[model samples]
Target chain A: MTAKITVEPSQKRQQAKQLREQQLLILAQQILQQDGFAGLTMDRLTALSSVSKGTIYNHFCSKEDLFTALSVDSLQRQLQLFQRALQIPGHSREQVLALHLAYHRFSMTEPTLFLCLLTATTPAVVEKSSPARLALRQQLELQLAAICQQLITAAIAEGSLQLAAGQSVDALAFVQWAQAFGANALLKPTQQLGLFSQLQPQPTMLLGVNLLLDGLNWKPLSSDWDYHASWQRIMTILATEAPGADGQLN
Target chain B: MTAKITVEPSQKRQQAKQLREQQLLILAQQILQQDGFAGLTMDRLTALSSVSKGTIYNHFCSKEDLFTALSVDSLQRQLQLFQRALQIPGHSREQVLALHLAYHRFSMTEPTLFLCLLTATTPAVVEKSSPARLALRQQLELQLAAICQQLITAAIAEGSLQLAAGQSVDALAFVQWAQAFGANALLKPTQQLGLFSQLQPQPTMLLGVNLLLDGLNWKPLSSDWDYHASWQRIMTILATEAPGADGQLN
Candidate 1:
């Protein structure tokens, strides 16, 4: 494995730094993919990456730092893919559909990485680490929010848009997002999730996009100033008593 | 730990046989709740429950058998609850909302039982022995189908319903289930899930449910169908996705 016999000190330093970074990432991915996030360790990293412990220390501040790099890479990939797709011309629904397909394909294509990032069980993981989960959710929301805005924009431009009182695009984005997460969470290989098997998340993920589009058809569907009315109703339901109501609130 | 034991041979035999079934189940639940399902073993059960190894052998064929018993019990609980809920008077939307609350409550209350029955991390689980998954999914679907029928009944009764092509209570049920799972899967314990603390689950879950309700609302504001449709949509988006899509079809 030692092909290089000699090198200048500066040249060797540069090469070692680059290689160490690569090694840390490779080991990180390996830990995430092969062992789950919980199994990731400096010992394992040293073994998998074939680097000295000190070299890894040179690159990352801590194990948390190493994991952060991995997460950022994953989220950036998703964002990049989403952005690239957004540039393609199609109906807002179709665009959302394409994004879903992309998501589906990504999940299947990189099962280990996909599951590692998306799943809670992956070893070497720190569940309380905000940089990982929050960044991920927020990144996803950003991409999805863009899609919602795009669709609503396109529909309005074409005069095919209609929306009822509470059909804001931002609100719709969360709807679409929640649905996607829902889809990802309960997916198994053999059992058909039953009904959602047909609508194809690729298109329907525009649940928000569709909500705005479809709501456009409703007579009361428009951006109005009735936020307080709905807020009061929700608060009343939430804060006040509904007879015989008993359940844990998040 | 043995007490003063002076049982006759026939009495010992009769007592062992009588206690075997309940003893095994209690031990299994205790093991699962304490050390997780992995702690459950025949040796452990024999030791923990203070039953003879041979007695355990007579009670359960294997660890798998014990787990299956637990699985069956949990499934039956859910099945009975769904059936009981169906007997009540409510709109389709209310019923679906109740179902969501009911499911959320079940997961929070009996988390260990929930994992044994539904949380399959092993890839070969559903494919190797699928009767459990199928039976459970089918059992839940019965409840879902009832809600779907109720939603349709209410919407049509109110005369303000319009569906965009494919819409079945079964499909609606699936969507609600999937969405709930998706939103839920992303959740981590509030304090520890990375840098963002406020991005907690309650709002995240609420966000998803709200979106589905919005999407599924196919009724004008003047009709009760609107409310029913909205609630059903919420259910479809939230509840439809928890089964994990790794090995299941949605």
Candidate 2:
């Protein structure tokens, strides 16, 4: 009974610490959204939050550390979305497509935070961040990559996907990631610039991912299946399953 | 006689201005390479260059304008490489592959300058850059897209490529651009982080572009042809055709 009493208070304290850290991340994200990266100084964050300067410092050693923390948060959120995306009932191809949709939706909804992924990787941010935080970020990245690798491996196991002579699941997973990143990065700019003015009004991300999946010779090719319908269905399920997922970040 | 004399002096002045601008850009690139984006400033640029401050201002209204000018220069160089890539004796598929190889080579050789493409597009830089420079950047972007479109169209014309019901040359060209951009951006970072350590020693960029091209159903698919051989041949040809393409930027 005495041990339980001691453990309960320690657990409570741990939970409290986590709650405070999460609150700080929300405040930091709000500041970043309002005033670009340049404006997100420790001083400004200290002034805006109810927390004390020393406590905030304890949470993040430097501004770059804070940026890394935000990136870690952003990636955690992406992982959740990917997990939610995989819950949809379908082949590995559809699950992969669902992952792309989740990524695209996340980028669209949290554009500012989405950029943290790029900013955190930059030398300027990485050099200043604490080793512990950097390790956490790398671990998260590997976790995300693992999710992709799992899908690819599952597809191969089920015989729905076949690796060419020199292809490996790791390389193919990396390719999908690059394609998704490339497509999302260009999506808004392409629209604003009217670069594809003559193209149809469909989702370019869907088209790009479909083409990549088709190239991999994944089963239920776009020609064989109505991926357009699958795209809509997956989106609907995600919306219902994780309503206001982006809002949770705030 | 008066007309010839007046024209001669004006032409000479223009030539001198162009020479000074090129020299300033070289100096700016050096500063960027040495000190990174933060170390670059008008004062620093003026201190390093032989040109007067007034002349520098005449060429670039702001530092962002200078970055845009650099991006314009980078794109122009890429266009030259693309044109040279097309000069190789091959089918449209091989030519498209050559374009990817040229892009990969450029990214590897002139990584700092290659980054100018992303830096110039940020809102911070775009808002500060001169309208004329921004317009030129847009024009260069279109010209690059046009090159990709022409290859896709030629492939279709030769019946070596086919588009789905909703696929258009414009969309496919944009996908290729996104794939190249995405793959290049991640390449060095992926290598440094050892993200795909288990993968073979092969160039992942080649694998990525091949997968994307295969997805498009371009002729001489990876299965049907030894694209690895073609990739090597293309690199050799580009190395010879442009002995120091990146050095030209410097």
lDDT of 2 by residue, B1-250 (tens): 5999899899999999888888888898898899976677799898898877888999999877998899898998899989889999988888988999899888878887888776675545665788888888888889999999898888898999988777878888888888898888776666666677665433677887787788888888888999899988999999887785454543
Off by over 4 Å in 1: A1-76, A89-101, A121-174, A190-250, B1-77, B110-118, B121-162, B187-207, B218-250
Output the number of the TM-score-best candidate. 2
Question: What do the candidate models score in CA lDDT, each in turn?
Answer: 0.51, 0.83
lDDT for each residue of candidate 2 in A121-140, tens digit (9 for 90 to 100): 55555667899988887788
C-alpha displacement of B71 in model 2, angstroms?
Answer: 2.2
lDDT (C-alpha) at residue A77 in model 1: 55
Residue B152 lDDT in candidate 1:
58
DockQ of candidate 2, scored on C-alphas against the true complex (2 decimals)? 0.44
Worst 10 residues of 1 chain A by lDDT: A238-247
| Colliding pairs, model 2 | none
Question: What lDDT does model 1 reach?
Answer: 0.51
Per-residue lDDT tens digits of candidate 1, residues A1-250?
3445445566888887866675577668867667555567787888777668887766665665565556545555556556555555544444554455455545555565554444333222332334544456555545555665676666657655554444455544444555655555445431353533444443333333344323335222323223223323333332243222122233
